[model samples]
Target: MVSRGYKKRGVGVMGLRHVKNPILLARAMLEHGEDDLEANPRGVNSGDLDVPSAQGHTQLYGKAAEQLAQQYELELVDPSYFFTQRRWDEHVRALEREKKGQGQATWSATEYLPQGTCGAVALDQDGVICAATSTGGLTNKLTGRIGDTPAIGSGFWAEEWAEDGDPTGSSTWDR
Candidate 1:
């Protein structure tokens, strides 16, 4: 599961039971469906193809991924695998803070806050760029709220680039 969120950002992936790493899961989901994209030219390099609705994030913690896992012979661990004393302690602290009205005031502090996502961006050996990210979300949050991390273009996005007139290859990419 993508994990739950705070008042600002909701849990992006809900009810994830056995998956250990969402980043890897997200990457797997991408790689798993890349062939389908390659076979269909209409989706190639199109942002629409990379959108969240098409990325299958909505199929979490249910029959869809479970069925796929079974078909692929993938191992599914108990949700207890995600349990940790440290995480529980953090959740307790967050709740205490909220009760005292000491919670964070802004969502923009995500990168610097105690809770945040992990991401990796790389220019692969084939010169193809790819990015991936995942988060456990805010502690003691609503389990059904999906955070931005699993929201495709919001938390992670990659697109091929080519410069038409820049010979020095110094053009900047902007969202």
Candidate 2:
């Protein structure tokens, strides 16, 4: 979303959507919230969110994201959009290791994997601050394993504060 010349929202991922570029998804959400704020000024409501299935160990968000994309008139791609042979093989190997009581091996591999959690922070010319992150939890994680990547504040955050009525100025410090 950074290269798109827009920076106004924060987002994080946790094995959901499986999109190759999660920034696009985060951008969409930011736009969605912007629209809501424009209309209500108070921000979006819970119902406005594209919540995923409340019950599901596998946590397939592709369908959910697709639905949201359709609603927002955004482009949608096939499952292969985020598919890769290396990732698939790694997932399979991790699963095998997990079944063989080698969960640590799977964790270690994920720790070093190049495709793990990602995050970004940006400040636009207009002073807009945006932060975002995305990740497909450790490869072959347990069925119910849910990481903090998808949770706001836990994975990423963006804040704006002014000191002495001047945002660009330094504030008085207290011990």
Residue 15 of candidate 1: its Cα lDDT?
49
Every model's TM-score: 0.61, 0.61
Candidates' lDDT values, in order? 0.50, 0.53
Report how far off residue 90 is in candidate 2 (Å).
Answer: 1.6
Off by over 4 Å in 2: 1-20, 34-62, 102-112, 165-175
- The weakest ten consecutive residues by lDDT in model 2 span 51-60
Residue range 1-175, candidate 1, lDDT tens digits? 2222211111233346765544445445544542333232334554423232213243354444543444334567888887788778766666666667767532224323465567766675776666656666776666677666666457656666555765566656421
Q: Model 1, residue 102: displacement in angstroms?
A: 12
